[model samples]
Target: MIIRILFLFTYLLFSAQLFAQVIRYNTVDFSGMAPFWQVESSLIKDTEPDPDEWNALFDAPPYQILMAGGFSQKEFEQQLRLAFMPSMGSLLRKELDKNNPKSNFLRHVMQIMGNEKKLKELQANLQKAQLIKTALSMAKELLPDSFLYARALPPVSFIICDKAISHAPTGVIIDLLFSMDFEAYVPYFIAHEAYHFYRAKIKVPNLPGHNQPEYPIIQMLTQMETEGIADQIDKKKFFLNRGPFAGYEWARSYQHYLAKSPQAILQLDEYFIRMATVPNSDSKIIEDLLPMNGHPTGYYMANAIIEKMGKRTLIQQTANPFAFIRLYQRVALKDKKHYPPFSSITMQYLRKLEQKYYLPKKAEQPKQKSSPKLMWYEKDKVINNW
Candidate 1:
């Protein structure tokens, strides 16, 4: 028994050493955020992140992005309360100021619910900067002119985003930089965001200025263009880390579904286009999106764009979302043999946009403080499409 125990211990240590690449990460956010999650507690049993669990997570859809449907079993409903509003910096400051064990919202979730394990895992993993370095290296190799390589990877401040990883890298946010369960694939996530940052800095023609939001359909197409290009860039490197299996699985499954039948996704695309360009596309369609969980799944469009454009051309249109959607139609129209017949209406709409003419905006979106602020092309319509 003693010998067996020793062997297991040795193997575990050896495995960790073998996988621990020497890399560094900007801890400004990691450090800032760690203390809030690292507090001591007695009500929790520590559970470690399983590197093997991402596939299972992907098997259930919401976990792919929203981290929903009990996919994590750890970070779902209970976790959402932890981040309903943007509170990372404020949260840390509050914790420090109060210093009272009773005052921390995270403590209630951690100790009271036995989820301190997830928090601890996040704290422990951020110290391993090698993964960050790996993510950056992969991005640079593929797109040598990446924002990360050009200006160096930015400081990533980790925060809980309801219950999933997302890139909201505006001003100083890093959108929950690393999750323990998904740590190995941190680079893939980084590379995706790196492209968004890079693409944002790029000035392309006919897009709205920073001060003004682009039309909803145009915004939808832009998201597809940028995200599709980012996927093309970061996807090549994920096999090495085995981190983004769920994400890749999602993209593949979406593409497969579209190949077989595209009615549903195309419905979403048409809805968005009408919202943006057609004066008569009923704004009431906004209510229909509530069923979708978080606006239409732009990732579907992202997959379609990548599928239609091929890797080389998709990469080339990273900054030009307008061109990206146009190319998707161009490719789809060219491949009529493999694809289902296009709705003549869709075909006609494509022609209008291709001719650089789009329907005039109908009624503009109504503004209200009660409603959550929305990005271009959508209000807080769905729960999962992020």
Candidate 2:
């Protein structure tokens, strides 16, 4: 018995060390922004940047991700140009022949960059924050079992950009201008996005058929599971003042949407009923019911699972959205007064969809000392088709 206890202790220690070694954080990719920042700090703030000076940015890993997602080189260039030379806004409008919403927003970003005082302050804050290191530590603490859920932990590349978004090919995009606004909560935001990046690596099933109603239904279920689980990592912290920037705009938006989730869930139930009954109904019709890409509704269901079933159960079933929905139904049915349960028909339809499309492989005992590494070449292939 003593020997067995010792062996267990040794195994746990070894596993912890291996987990630490596997997940890596990188900011070398963000060095691509150095030249652009240099140009911005120059007195030629109003002058259009020479295309060559900032052109290399489009080839950066994060921008390469944008291209893989179907953005064109011309569109990428125009976006960077808008940020780099906000003073040329008039000329940009004339060239484009109409107002571009993204360009309009970047023009405002340029106004801040054009101000030397604000620009220096922003740069100084970012340098002082040690964001990458802090975020890495936070991610480890927030989701210690990330490796168990994901096949491998790819190097998380932190890129400075004008907007925040999830599951970039390499990692998460951080909006440089708004980094300070997040302040002490940067780690939380980064950790949230890191969950998304890791979760994105999980593979789902193939489509049922070409232009089939099942396609949209599968897409909706996938989004709900994806955003729901990721939101579990960070959204609650925002609500509870777990960070310095509590009640910030983004947090407030999440809070607002979450409050509306009950209604949304009810509406979603109705949609699911239609999906189950109306054979020829366009599954795309349900798109209108999902606000904020189904984050709030998904988050609500995830919270239910965490409350009734357990976080471990949710994490263990991370690869299966069908499992996620069923778990939520179990919780909701138990508390029918407070939680609206899915109709039997809707539940049956969902199960039918799952069985038809999702083919789960048999569970195997995890190999000891298994260290799966997702290399850049493999990552690039994933992004190319992403």
Candidate 3:
């Protein structure tokens, strides 16, 4: 029995050594990436650590790399070097700034973990193996950009991890399951957050009476606006066959959600009606849960205005959310044929501007060519153009 135990221990130690020796890469192939984007992975293995400590030593690199040919440690590092330039200065800065507020925040969380005897218990609940696998799958599909462009400032970074937490570099880290599912919902979610980010950066003005002063109300309204616009874009693009996915369910759900607010309904009717008249009107499903007391109508209208303006204009005009509103009101008022009594007159000019500049051009189809002729030789005869 003693000899058997000793043999098993020896085997375990050897296996640990093999696992520890595995090299992981920290770079992404950007050559084939789209304009202003490159995909990156988050995990990499360390070399200096003892074999038994491999799991404890897995570091989240700034970026992850897809290796070439083999999964061996040497190939991993070779691919890493090919894809990224490691800056000692950046590393030094990150290390030295441990006392910064973000770092402090992380420190506080770490302390909490230490004090809460249940920290390990919670960690165990996370199922790290499952999280890592999910993250790997997401990395394969999303092809997330390793670097952000100067002009393209994403408001929220979708992170996949075991726990639900927020980090400075990572943005929001939900369970790896949510992050994996994010691929299905990301187009709309990204659009929504991007609007809010643009608005914050530009200091957009809030509505008069609707100017949010408290927490839930402000958060709710902001979410409504962001999500509403995202839904509109998704519907329009999808219906026209220009977007990643095809469907109108998400867009209708957004409209329905917005209509639930009475205050928004009173202010946004005309806008919604206009949106409902857009190319894919049948896709919108406004429930009869609320009467036409202007509240529900107003909510849809607001979304329509944002939708009509499109993302480029939204980004540019986001300096003042009020400006967009004012512009929308003006255009709504000027359309004598469709204008409501209180609609702002700037609508006409905005409409003209949209007609002149905002409409997206249709994608061109590739030209077709005639099929090529083939030649064949049989055992006894030669055939041409077969």
Task: Pick the lDDT winner.
Answer: 2
lDDT of 1 by residue, 1-386 (tens): 00001001111112221111221223334432432332211112233223343234233221222232123445432333333223444654465467453234344333323445655566566655664566566555435254444444544445542323433322122334224445655566665555555566665455444443234445555555554456555443442134344245444543444343445445655765674467576544543442222212334445555576655565565555445555665656777554333455655564555445333346788786596766866744554565
| Structural similarity to truth (TM-score) of each candidate | 0.49, 0.68, 0.32
Against the reference, the lDDT scores of all candidates come to 0.43, 0.61, 0.32
Per-residue lDDT of model 2, residues 124-188, tens digit only: 66666666566555554324374533433334333444344334434444455444444455566
Sort the predicted structures by lDDT, highest score first.
2, 1, 3
Number of the top candidate by TM-score?
Answer: 2
lDDT of 1: 0.43
**Worst-scoring 10-residue span by lDDT in model 2:** 1-10
Instruction: Give candidate 2 misplaced runs (Cα > 4 Å).
Output: 1-25, 44-103, 111-167, 206-210, 239-253, 359-386
User: Compared to the true structure, candidate 1 yields what TM-score?
Assistant: 0.49
Q: How many clashes would you count in candidate 2? A: 0
